[model samples]
Each structure stands twice: as C-alpha cells, then as structure tokens.
Target: MDQRTDRPLSPYRHFSRADWARLREDTPMTLTQEEVTRLRSQHDRLDMAEVEDIYLPLSRLLSMYVAATQRLYRAQQKFLGTGDAKMPYIIGVAGSVAVGKSTTARVLQALLARWPNVPRVDLVTTDGFLFPNAVLERENLMERKGFPESYDISALLRFLSDVKAGRRPVTAPIYSHLVYDVMPNHRVEVDRPDILIVEGLNVLQAGRPPRDGSAVPFVSDFFDFSVYIDADEPVLREWYVDRFLRLRGTAFSDPKSYFHRYAKLSDKEAIDTATSIWERINLVNLTDNILPTRQRAGLILKKGANHLVSDVALRRL
Candidate 1:
C-alpha cells in the first residue's frame, strides 16, 4: 500500500508520479503522439511522457471502477427482479479555470472510449449549463459568469437525473468559446453511453439545499467518481495569462470572436488585461468556490509547472 503524510491530517492516500506509474504496469500505451497533440487544449503542454506517467494509470483505474460498478448495478437489479437496464457511469472532473481540467476530460474521454467494455464515452461540460449571456446580463451576473449562481442548477440536476434514469437522446445546451456565450437553439444530444464525464469548475460543489426540508440532488450526487485537478495559485495564474496571450494571437484575432478587441492589444497590454481578469474574476472564483470543493473529489491530480501532474491523492475507502 502506498501511503504518505505529505497532506497531514488528510484522508487521501498520496502517490508520487513514479508510484502511480507502477500501478499501470502491463497496461498498453494505446495513444499516439499525434493523438495526444490533437487532444490537448490550445497553449496547453501535454506530451506522451505525461500521459504514460499520469493519465494512463488513471484510465486503467477508472476502467476497474466502471467494471465493478456495473457488476454492482447488475446485482442490485437482480435482487429487485428488475430488467437489465444499465445506467451510465458518470465521472465528474472539477478544477479552477485554466487548470487543464478540460484537457484531462477530453483525454479521458478518448482513452476510455477505446476500452473494450467502454465503447461509448461522452463528455459534457458544465459550461453548457451556464445561464445564457443575455440572461446573465439581464440579471447583472455578467461579471460572475463562472460562479455557481450563474448556472441553471435545477436544469443541470434534472439532466443528470434523466441520465441516471437511462434516458436516451438527452440534449444539453451548447456553449461556444468563440462567442463567449451559450448558443440559443443549439444543443448536443447524448445518447445512452456506457460512461459520461461531466467536467466543470463547480461539478464537485454541493448545491444549496431547498427550504422545504425535502432532499435535493446535487450535481455531484450523480457522479460515480470525481476528480479535481489542482496546482499552486501562482502557477495557475501564470498559465492562465500565458494561455490568454496565445489565444489573442489565434481565436481572439478572428473578427467574429467576442474578444476580438483583445487581438489588437500589444503583448504587454494583453498580459496586463489577462492579469486583471485573473485577479478580479478567476482568482476570486477559485478561492471562494472551486478550491473549497477539492477535498470532495474521489481523486485529486496535483500538477507542477509545465502542466505535468506530479502527485495524485486518492480518497481512502
């Protein structure tokens, strides 16, 4: 058993990258460098070594969890004398903005789908659950776009409910980064998949309880497993600023982009603007809402500089 006291008083079993890599012994490396290159987010650095050292082991562990859950579900159904309807196993990925959670989700989706038992794995981002820009502007929540209150929490809960109920052809709203808003009349359909990954900054958060004393389901309540991607605040801020500058040259440069104005800014001016946004919005959200929920995750991926995961903390059973 690998154990450490680095997180003193914590309930998680810590593992360094070397120890974690050993857990994936004999697991084949199925992803190619080209595939990893395409899966990484813009300006994010993810290479084959990182995948082998960190994510390959993660995928193998998730595979075992999924299989065990499937068996348990079958046992429950047999005991209930119910038919063989399978519920999708949901995995929640939560973290601060620009912490590479999206990349992790995408990479896992690609890897898990290739597994023999998990032929269909879909990823749904909570970004889609965010209230439309028009609604946010009307409610004076534009400044708190990524905050928990800015999302359609009830709708998100209902969607998860339907998914857990094995509903087919479930549709979720589509959010566009280029437009910086949810696209009205646009939606993504999720058929019954074997596994579903829900990725967002608030996916691990516990929702506010209703006043009626009745039980209200939280977004995390639907997750079978949850992951939190973490890094030092200074490192995350630097990464955010670097990504912002890189995007200014690509996405922001497009005339139709919502942030087109940023494309014309000089390097120094862009850095200043990015820093301001981080300090004002992203940092506040991370400290007040996101970071507090890190301990709630079943597994935590702690990253070092250059976006490499240096350590992992698995929640003790």
Candidate 2:
C-alpha cells in the first residue's frame, strides 16, 4: 500500500492505525467513564468509544513528540555548554467554530496526562484573548467574533512566545462564555508545563510584515506542532446550525449569555437566524482567514457529515 494515503495522517505521513496502535501500546487512558461522560455532557454527541478510537492514539503520538522535544533540548544545551530551562511543547489546534477543536484539545490533554513522562499538560483557548464585548461593539465587530481582528493578537502571540521561551509565571486573561467577553481581572497561570495545547479559530494564521517591512512573530511560529480540523463547508453549516439549536434551549436561555435572545425564537426563526449568522460571520471568516492556513499545519483531521473524523492528511515529514 502507498502508506502515505493508506492511514490517518500525522506529521509523518505514512502512519497507519495499526502503526498508531503500536505506538499506543504503553500509553495510558487516564479518563474514567465518569470523567469522559462529564466531558461529553457539553456535547452529547461525543462518546467515550469515539475518544478511545480517535484521540487515544493521537495523544500517544503527541507524548512521543513531547519526549523527543525534551531530548533535543537537552542535546542542544549540552552542545552549547550552557544550561537552560526546559520549555513547553506547544500544540496549536485550529478549526471553524462548532468543528470540535475544543473537544479535541480537552481529550488530548486528558490522555496526554496519562503518560508518566509528561507531568504537566495545560490547555488554553484563544477565546480569552478576544477583545471585550464593549470593545468589539464599539469597533462594529461583534458579529465577527471569531475573526482574527477580533482578538488581541499581539497579546496572544506574546503569551505563546513567553511559554516557548521558557518563561515562568505567565498569565493569560480568562473569558466567560456567560458574559461572552474577556474577564479583565481573571487570569489563568502557567508556571511552566511539559505540554501546552493552544486551541483557537485562527491560531495558524501567518504573519504579515509591518508597514516598516519588519517581520513579526505569529502564534503559529511558536507551535511545535499544529492540527487543523476540516470538513465540507455545507457539512459545517449544518453542524453549526444543529449546535446553535441545541444551545438555544440551554446556554442561550440564560439571561447572561450574549445569545440569550436567540433562545426565545421559534424553530423556523431560529434556523433562519442560525443560517444567516453562519453565512454572514462564520463562513466568511472560515473562507477568508481560517481555511487558507490549513496547509501550514503539521496534520489535518478531515470530518464527514456525521461529524466523525474520516480522513487524515499529514504534511510530508
């Protein structure tokens, strides 16, 4: 078989599920049924079985990468004859909204934690770096919530840069979904982790030169590895609409939610609203910004209409 296309993709293209299974032989699954159930509660469509099948092997592979990074760092230090602190292996996960990137990050964190070699695993979402709702409103960009310009990009880049540079006691702003805004006073600290997963919609975007023609560092530049979750636009549209309808009865019902007003709409009205939002906001952002960066990732997870990852495309090693 042309192993490159025969198996699920990774940074190394020729890996198969069997190959992954072999890599996972000693890797552990730390998540209990109760934990997995609790994790899946937010997205009832995900089950433990899917996690074991899709994520377990991937986490194992990441564990290996994490180990390899540590070894490389130690070797570089020895060659330089100077000691330096170990930095985090930063992983970037990018995808369209409702495309399951959050779930992927959480699952990988849980599974990667099970590897004894990796002591600490931290997951941070770029949502916290999003501009405050008031700022977004003033900029007339509340509708472009997940677009690149909606974020405090320099702040996000600095956080990743610090982490990769072995900086300690780094703190990032926290976001509240209820308020749909960045919480000014609240922050999440990373003293220093063995592995860090940064999940967001546009984390893989390339940097553009400044007006002075000077280079600027982008978030993806700090990534040790990156994954792009992808699917047909029509399929994503349907998924987004379905998730919106589900949230309308739940999170959207809470008065504090920015989308609370949506919960009160009738079924037909809700679907129309969801479709319009997708067409106007999410789809436009995906095409113009998100999808264009897919080739920059180390791996690509391709999903089917059922929302299952049916294909994998790994970049050439």
Candidate 3:
C-alpha cells in the first residue's frame, strides 16, 4: 500500500505576522491614528499596529506591483502604437461575509492613494451588483442572495470590461445595507484611476468553464492582484454574530432600517436569530462559494481568533 501523504504542495510562501511586519522595511506609514480608526467598521478589531504590521508591508508590495504593471502597460501601448487612455490596475479583495474584506479594501485604498505620484485609487464593492430585493423576491431567490446566480454577473462583467478597455466615467450601481437593497436609480461613478479595489464575498470565484472553450470572463480576470481574508469557521461565526448583535442597538433600531424588527429581540433571542441566519444564509454561502476561491488569491491574510492577522501567505509567481 502506498503510504505517501495526500496533501498537495502549497503555491504560497507563508510568513508569520512578525516576519511579514519586517518586510515593511522602510515603507513609510502614511495613515494617521484617526484615519485608521475612521476606516475600521463597528466590529473590526484592526488598529494602528495592525495597519503598520499587516497593511504597510502589503501597501508597499502593491505599490511596487502597480508601478511595474503601469510601466509594462505603457510599453505595450507604445509597441502597438495605440493612443488609448491610461489603463487602471484592478485589485480584488475576497473573503467570507464577516471576515473584514471592506476594512482591508479601505485601508489599502487609503495607503495606495497616499503613494507619491499615484493620483487616484477608487474602491467599489460587489454588493451593488446584487439583484434588487424585489427581483430576488420575484425569483424566489431571497435565500440565495449572496450566491453567484443572485448577481447581475453580465452587467458586472461588462462594467469591468469597459474599464479595462480604457472607458471613462464608468458607473456602478449603489447598494444600501441600511435598507437591505440595491438603491433604485442610484449609482457611483468610477473614472480611470491609477488603482481600483473591488471587494466582495466571492470576487475570486471562477465557476466551472464551458466545455466549448469559449471565452468566459470572470470578475477576477481583470485583477492585477487579489487578496483573500481567512479565519477559522468558529471565529468567523463569532464575528458575524457579534456584528449582528451590535447592529441591534444601532442600525437595526432605526425605524427605517431593514432589520428594524430584529432590534426588539431579547439578548438570547437575538443570539439565536443571528446564529440561525448565519448558519442558514452566510455560512452556507461561504462554504459553498467563497472559501473554495481562497487558493486563487495572490495573497491570503490568515486571522487568529482575536481577529488579528496571524500570518501572511504570498503566492509564489
């Protein structure tokens, strides 16, 4: 009988948080304590130290990558003798629902925008691409809201395609978490930026390709770099539940809030409700879709129970 281990080789060069922090090496910290605090979400545990140790090194590396990519883009344009508009470098941030993907995107956006001579760094979340609540209700897909099929994938792909084709003033639909819907007739504009950060639960997910070998553009196809935020399932559940609980006293309490009904839930009742929703909706989505795409990321931030990044895995080129 063959006794060899079945585990496959990892394509990433993993580093402990301390070692990764050392890689920051001369990368000037541009974000202030106030800025860091402002960028964080209600349940996010990230701080100035986390920014310096985890994000600064990442910011430095991304700066290098963006610069190199732009240089090559210019060279390619020159070779082809095409006078196209400036091309933007796109970055994708993907993870489980409560794993702090927005926090990562905002931190990176702020840091990269502060880079010398890099003018604009815009960030957009995939929530906007989700089908409207009415549409989901009509289609009886409310339970599958975060799944790939629930998204207007064609519109999303077209938006990315236009941006990559050097189209200007591209508009993306806006979403309202407060009302739990894609706000009607609301949109945000994205001009050609030096960098664009696209954050979502499953932006890196590439479903099975067609047997015909026809071109199937994935959201990740336009990404110059991609990041996946990872944590243990129990830790993620805790965070999600905690965030839901916190919302009870805040957003959920507002009369116009979509989750207003949840505000009056007793502590025990709220806990049960949150856990059930998590297990039923978010957890299923994470396991069925998001986690499978982790290996496709260019970098993975592994978080410990306390929500601090315990290690970094940088994919080897």
Candidate 4:
C-alpha cells in the first residue's frame, strides 16, 4: 500500500490558516470599524481579524492571478496583432449552499477591485441561471433547486463564453434571496469588466458529454482561477441551520420572501427542517457533485468548526 494512503491528510501542506494575522501584511485593511461591525451583524461571527487573516492573503493571491492573466492577455494580443479587446479575468467560486461561497465572492470582488489595474470588478452568481420556478415545478424538480439539472446549462455556458470572448455588456438574470427565486425583469449587466467573479454551488462541476457524442465546454472551462470553500460536513450543517435561523429573523420576515413559510416555524422545528433540507438536498449535492471537484480548483480554503478558514490548498504549479 502507498504510504500516502496510510497517513492522514496533512492540512498545512495545503496552506496553514493558523498564523493568518502575520500573512495578512501585504493585503490592505481599509474597512472602518463601523463598516466591519455592520458586515459582522449580517455575517455575525466574522470580524476584522478574520478578514485580515484569511481574506487578506486570499486577496493578495487573487491579485497575483489577475495580474498574470492580464499579462497573458496582452502577450496574446501582441502576438495576434489584432484589435481584440482584453477579456475580464474570470474566476469561478464553488461550494455547497451555506458554505460561505457568496461571502467569499463578495470579499474577493471588493479586494480585487481595489487593485490599481483591475478596478472594475463584477460579481455574478449562478443562482440566476437556475431554471425558473414554473419550469422547475413543471419538471417536478422544485426540491432540486440547486442541483445541476436545475440550471439552464447551455445559457450559462454561452454567457461565460461571450464574456470570455470579449463581448460587450453581457446580461445575466438576477436572483432575489428574499424571493428565493430569479426575478424575470431584473438582470445584471457586466460590460467589459476587469474581473468577473462567478460564484455558485456547483461551478466546478465537470461537463457532461453531449448525447450525440460531441465535445462540450463547462462553465469552469472559461475560468482563469477557481476557489473551493470546504468544511466538515457536520460544521456545514450547523452553519446552514444557524444561517437559516438568522434569516428567519431578518429576510424571512419580508412578506414577499419565499422562505417566509420557514420564519413561522418554532426553533426546534426550524432546526429539524434545516437538517432535513441538508440531508435531502444540499448534503447529497455536496458529496455527489461538489466535493469531487475540489481538486479541480486552483485553490481550496478549508474551514474549521469555528467557521474560520483553517487551511488553504493551492494546486502545485
């Protein structure tokens, strides 16, 4: 047997998050105490320390990737001797629901946007690419909301392709967390962004073969870099439940919120419902689809039970 198979996986070999304070030196911390406090109110346990530690270094790393991508684009432009406009440095952020993927995307967008050369950053979530409620209902897959089948895969692929091909002003549907659905009339337009961060639960999923056996490209194929946020299954479950309860008090209270039904549930009932949703949908998707794609990421952030990133896994160049 291989010795590697016998030993437990080494976390630090990925990227140790233990001494994050020190590694944060290169990244800027511009948020005021009030700003951080407000953000923390929404993200409760997060603080300036966590931002300085995990996100700071992460921002620095992404800056490097963005710079390199720009250089590559310029070099290709020079070689081709054509007037092709430079495309955005596209990043794919992937993880299970409630795994902090949205937070990661937002933070990265904020940090990357500050870089001198890449000031225009756009963040797009795959939630908008999900099939409409009516379609899902007709397909009898309302419960499979975040599953791969729930998406308009071809549309998502074309959108990424157009953005990567330097198309001007690509529009993607907007998903309202309050409504827990995509609003047909509301769409976000990304017009020649310097950096485009595409975040979703399954962005790293592999492409399926065409029924006619032709090759097909996946959404991830257009990414210059990718991130996978990971945590223990139980920790993730707890986070999901905790976030649900918090939203129950906040967004779920909105009369138009699709999850308003959940807001009325008692604490124990809410916990049971959260756990059931995890077991039935999110957890199954994570194991069957998301976790297997971790190795495909350029970097992976592993979180501990405390919801703080404990390790970073960067693919060996």
Candidate 5:
C-alpha cells in the first residue's frame, strides 16, 4: 500500500491500527459509547471500538504535543523577557470532502476536552469562511464553492491571526448547510480555548508568494499540529454519493432547503446528479488543491473502504 504517495521519501513513520493501538497503553479511554455516537456525523459509521482503537491514542499523542508546546512557549517568553501567557494549541484537520474530517474534528474535540490538562477545546470549520452565495454568484464562482479561490482567504487569515494572538471571543461567521450559504449576522464565538481545532479542505495548502517578495503566511502557519484524513479516490466518490442520497431523503426534503429540488429526484436521478457533482466539482478541488497538501500534514489518518482508520502516519521530528 503506497500510503504516502505525495512524498517519495516520506518523513512519516507509518503504523497499522494494531500497532497504533498499542501506543495507547495506560492512556485512559475516557469516552463512552454514547459520546462516540453523539460525535459521529449523520450517515457516518463510528463505533466505540473504532474510537478506542484510533482516536484515544491520537488524543493522547496530541495532549503530549500540546504540553510540549506550552513548555516551549514559556521558555521563549523567559528568553525574550516577556510576561507568561499561554497560547492556545491550534490543530488543523484537512481532507477531501465526504472523507469524515468533520467527524474526526468533533471526536477529537470531545476526547481532548475530557483530558484534565486541556479542558476547553473549540472546533471551527472553515466552511464559515467561504464566500457567500451572492458574492460567489457575482464572481461566477457558485459552481466552484469548495475551491480555494471561492474563500475569503484574507478574512480567514485575520481570524486565525486573532486566535493565535489570544484575542478572546474571536467571532467567526456561521455557514448554513440547509441554506447553502454563509449566514449573515450569525457568528460563532471562540473564547480563549486551551485547544482549537480548525477543520477544512484546504487548511494544509501552501500560500502563494507575493509579487513584492515579502512573506505571506498561510493558515497552516498558525497550526501547532495538523492532521490529514486519507482515503482512496473511489471510496470518497462512493461516500459522497451516499451522503448526498441520505441528505436528499432528510435535509433536502425540507421545503426551506436550498437543495430541496434534489428531494424530488428519483433514486437513479439522484445517483446521477450526485455522481456528476462529485466528478465536476469535488474531484477537481481534491486533485488540484487538497491532495497536493497531504505531505504538509504532521499526521495522516488513512481510512479504508469501511470508513474506519486503518493506518496512521506520523511525521518524524
């Protein structure tokens, strides 16, 4: 299995599920089955076994990384003669759409908060940073919603900067899936959390250089740690279609849903529409943007067809 295809000579240390599970020895499994069920997304399959085998160990490793980061910050403060103040450990989770990145972020948030040292964990999705429907339509980017160009990159960078600088109560715009737009006047407030998980498709992407030859930091620059969720291309397509079908029967059936038209589609028509959307929009974004950034992640969770993590790759120091 060529897991790390982006890097011919990968710096990551790969581990199978069994081997990764062993590393969690003596680490407390604080989450219950109920909590796992609650954290999982609709139409996604996540069980306690998977949580115990995969996320528990990941949470432990992240906690250690967070602790080490705090120490490093304090040492820097002392060296620079600055006052002591803790910065939130920011984690970026990136992956192809329908590859379970949202569930992964939610699971991590729930598990990490249970740890005594890191009680406050906040999760913010970059969906909120996407251009509004009106703006996208005006720019002729409605069909390219998930693409990097369709986001307000400057706004995202500013939000991340404020969060990294410990600007409390940093507000983020809220995105509405039902409305298929960035909701105006709705915001999610992030009070100084101990750990913040920023989940999105392009969080790991490198920033373009400026014409002035000055430095421009990508959002990944603010990350203390980053995770990339991986899966086969075919598997992602299948999952995307499946999720679309599920949503058609649920959210799309609602009269107010932006995708309500899909609710009236027959099974065959829905399948065709979903497959077309995936091939046209999602696939292009994945190939042109998301997949290229895989090598930039500190950790990779490779999932199998079953939608469960089968292996992990941790970047070596």
Candidate 6:
C-alpha cells in the first residue's frame, strides 16, 4: 500500500504493522534469535519475528539513506576540491523511560552493522552526560534526575558537535546504573564510526532560542534520522513499575548498588515505592519534556500494551 493519504495537512502518514512489514521486501535477515535476545532489554521482549517485521524494514531504509548521504558527500568533495573526512551518519532514538528505547537502539545497531557494506556502528546513550549524583544532590536536583535541568547539556551538545565535525577519538563520560552516578574518569570513545546511534530520553528535545535568533545547536541538529518510541502514559507507567520490580531482585540486591536498600522491600512496598517514584520523577519528566518532542522525530514507533510496536508513523518529506 502507498503512504499517500487525503489529509494533506497531516505531517505523518500512518502505517499498520502489516503494511510496514511489506516494506522489508526481500531484505535479508541478519539477526539470529539468540542475537536478538542479547540485544533486548530486560523488560523488553524482541524475538526474531519482530526483527523481521519491524527492524529489517527500518534497517533497509536507513541503509538507503546512509548510502545516499555518502554519495552526496563524495559529490560535494569533487565540486569543492576538499579532502575532509565524511561525517558520521547520526541517528537519534528518543522515548520516555522504560519504553524500550534501549532495546530499539541496540537492535538497530546490531542490524545496521551487519549490512553487507560492513559499516561500523556505535551506540551512545545520553545517560553518560547526566550530572553526577553528588552534583545533583548539591544542586537540589536529585529529585528531578531525568528532567532537562539534570543534564550537562553543554557537554552533550559539544560531543555531538565534535562527532559531526569528524573529530577523531571523541570521548563521552561513562555512567554506572548500579551506583546511579557518573563513573570517575571512565569514558567511551567515538572514533569516526560510519554510523552513530544516540539513544536517550531527551535527545530530541530543543531549548528556547535567543530573541535575536543566533544559532543554538541542539542534540538533534546532527542527526541524519531520528526515531521516537511511543506508548500511552499508563502503558509506560506499567512498564516502568515492572522494570523496577525486576531490578529489585537483581541489580538492587547488589551490595554496591545505590538502590540496594530497595531489595528487601515487600511487594506492596515495592509497588508503592515504584509508583511514587514514577509519579514524582518519571511521569513529571515525561509530561513536561519528553512527550512534547515526539513529533520532531522523522519516525515514530507506536507501541501496544504488549510493549511491541503496533504502528509506525513517518513524517512526510
């Protein structure tokens, strides 16, 4: 089926799950079931079928975009007579917390890297750019951890700037989910990869521009393509609570974990605590910051209560 619709003013043309799958059209499957299991998040289930139906089409589309971009870059160099390195093809993946953003990013990375051209792919999360817990506590922003204010946005922007400039060996901070803090002196380096997938809650967010209209670079500025994982607020809350409960038995049980105290909580207490955190922190952040930027993405994956993507929306060019 074609993507054309009668509603000309609508920016997006919607696609049913089955219609989207048809776009895959003879694209070879590169992922094994075991590989998909490794790429999925603990709270997200991604099977081989989902990979074939949703991600293979996406991978095919991205490959075409990347190839076209590369060709344009080569043409530009011939016209300008400059030998500068080609910049990385940046893809931004954004969503509310626990909406399976990580799973989507990881799966895309795996699938894209397996393309026949053997393009190098790297995944970076905005978590590493978040302010340290100590800094958050000192600034009294610990309670608003995922809010836009809690990030060192300047650093994140600078990192994206360097990557787009074809900078060599750019480094970003490393964060420990176990300690709930940025690690001391730990870093992940991005060294001129062919493709870089940036995944985060607020990667697609923008800030107020100056009244004079001077340039202000946002994280999404460098992206060649952007994807937003979407679900209803209630579904997101349920997924978040389920993830919290699962972590309580695993990561939270570690003595060194920042949330170790939560391990011994009774199920009722866990539910109450999880719901409280959701209401205070995640829900507020989602409403105030994340959901507002959903339309900015080139692609949106609308998920069902089952946490699998049920519909896809593409912004018409």
lDDT of each: 0.91, 0.82, 0.91, 0.82, 0.91, 0.93
Most lDDT-accurate candidate: 6
lDDT of 2 by residue, 157-220 (tens): 7888788777888999999988788988999999799889999999998756467755355888
**After superposition, candidate 5 runs with Cα above 4 Å error:** 1-8, 213-215
Candidate 2 runs further than 4 Å off: 1-26, 211-216
lDDT of 6 by residue, 170-197 (tens): 9999989999999989999999999999
Which regions in candidate 1 have their CA more than 4 angstroms from the true location?
Answer: 1-7, 213-215
lDDT of 6 at 164: 90
Question: What are the root-mean-square deviations of the candidates from the true structure over C-alphas?
Answer: 1.3, 2.8, 3.5, 3.3, 2.5, 1.5
How many residue pairs clash in each candidate at the backbone level?
0, 0, 0, 0, 0, 0
TM-score of each: 0.97, 0.91, 0.95, 0.91, 0.95, 0.97
Distance from true location, Cα of 70 in model 5, Å: 0.8
Residue 251 displacement in candidate 4 (angstroms): 1.9
The residue-by-residue lDDT of candidate 4 on 1-317, one tens digit each, is: 12235546643235466554466666678666665555443643666777888888878877777778778988998999977877888899998777788777877777677776647999999999999999999999998889899999999988998898878879999988777788989999999898899999889998665787553567888898899988889988888899888888899888988888888899999999999999999899998988898888888888888877877777656
Q: Write one digit per residue (lDDT tens) for candidate 1, span 1-317.
A: 35544546778888888999889877788889999999999867999998888888999999999889989988999899989679999999999999999999999998898786547899999999999989999999999999999999999988998898888889999899999999899998889889999999998887667878565558998999999999999999999999999998899999989999999899999999999999999999999999999999999999998788988999988
**Candidate 6: regions farther than 4 A off:** 2-8, 210-215
| Candidate 3, residue 171: lDDT | 94
Model 6 worst lDDT window (10 residues): 1-10
Count steric clashes of candidate 1. Answer: 0
Candidate 3 per-residue lDDT, tens place, 34-135, comes to 999999988998899999999999999998898788789789999999887778899999999889999999999999999888569999999999999999
Mark the 10 consecutive residues where model 5 has the least summed lDDT.
1-10
- How does model 6 score by TM-score? 0.97
